[model samples]
Target: MAPTFYHRWPEPVTEKSGSMVQSQCWGWKCLSFGLILVVLGLLVPLIIFAVRANSKACKEGLLAEQECRTVTRLLELQLAQTRQDLVGAMGEAATCNQTVVNLSTSLEMEKARGLEHLTRREELQREVEKLKEKLQKASEEAERLRKEKEAWSKQGETSFGSSSKLLSPLMVPVCLFLGLTALLA
Candidate 1:
């Protein structure tokens, strides 16, 4: 026969309530709890690292956004200044164009005046030439009349008698005076 141990009274059935302390399930509960603690322990550091990385990236993104806004503002101001300068340059160019037109008109008027003065001077020169020719012809006529009067006086003195001689002497002085007047004129 094998040695056997036996109790006279029956033990209580504590496992039916599902309580770990009263049952043999304490080891299983402890094992499950330990597994959860290990998983949380590893995940906590991973979550902390991800959070730090996200925070740094957010800060960098904000800084870049601020810099972009500042650059955009500067470009807009420069564009406005360039536009203003362009407008001023256009106005100056318009004024210069008007000045050129006015100068051209004044030059045309001056040229016309110069032409008129040249025409008047040519007319005066033509009139002077005509007057010089008329003056030369008048001088030639006076000299021919003086020669004819002297020949007539000598012929009249020989044809008349002694009574005519007294008249001839008086007429001689008168003819000489008239001849002198014609030459002076």
Candidate 2:
């Protein structure tokens, strides 16, 4: 009869007759150990390659970071310089604006003064015209009196007998002329 499932078992190694070397029989245990060794051998070289690549990448990253820091520091200094320049420019602009305001105010004041001066000049001109008119009138009146006096003197020489009446009217005209001249002057 064929053997049943529970009755089956692996046979053990027995000594070989007429052989000098003993036969080895480790079975599944040897196969599993060899497989584990092959896998570990492949993983060791991959781990070394990964470590070298990682270290190289880390060095490159450090250099890049240092370069970036240098650039950032230079940019920061430039920014500070630009800010100072801007502040100086703004101060100059403010000064210029104030100067412009002052100039405008001075110009306006000068204009007002000029207008006032012009008004004074006009008034002076009118006064000069009035004085000239008064002077001309006075000169004409003096010439008329001189002509009248010449005529009266000639008549008095001819009519010396009635000199009292002619002299009285002549004195009145002369006095009035002198008074007008004094007032005009």
Candidate 3:
């Protein structure tokens, strides 16, 4: 009697509304399904061809990706430097922590022995505080360098997963590692 929100579909033009509705729904579904299949069928072969062609192109020219190889070498050098820095920071932190412990121990001893010079106790305390600060700074540097090393490692992994691995053998350790694992397995 009155228009409602549910009246969006076209009302049947004839008494055979059921048949017309069925045809309309089935026609759309079939057309859409066919289009999807056609698109996938065309796309799959095209993608495969592109991949093979790219690989073939890489195999053809060795120097074509010289820039990529140079970049990879630079990244590797940076990673090595980062690793060295992390190690140095860790060593410095360990040394500072040891010095703090030594200073703290001597300070306790000086207090216990009733050292006549209060200046000695105060000096030890100041040295201990300075060492603690140095230890904290060294620890933070180590952590930061560790994170940077990890980021560089991840970036190296992703960047080499493509044709670069095929073109440059030395920089792509992930592929070699995988191959070795596969053999071992």
Best candidate, TM-score:
2
Query: RMSD, each candidate, Å?
Result: 16.9, 10.7, 48.7
RMSD of 1: 16.9
**Candidate 3 C-alpha lDDT tens digits along 15-75:** 5988888899999999999999999999999999888877967656655578788999999
The 0-to-1 C-alpha lDDT of every candidate, in the order given, reads 0.73, 0.77, 0.74
Better of 1 and 3 by lDDT: 3
Q: Summarize candidate 1's per-residue lDDT along 11-122 as a digit string, tens digits.
A: 4656754564544577877888999999999999999988886897877988999999999999999999999999999999999999999999999999999899889788
Candidate 2 per-residue C-alpha lDDT over 29-124 given as tens digits, one digit per residue, 9 for 90 to 100: 587789989999999999998888689787799899999999999999999999999999999999999999999999999999999999989987
- List residue ranges in candidate 1 displaced over 4 A: 1-65, 139-185
lDDT ranking, best first: 2, 3, 1
Ordered by TM-score, highest first, the candidates read 2, 1, 3
State every prediction's TM-score relative to the real structure.
0.45, 0.55, 0.28
Q: What is the lDDT for 172 in model 3?
A: 42
Q: Indicate whether candidate 1 or candidate 3 has the larger TM-score.
A: 1
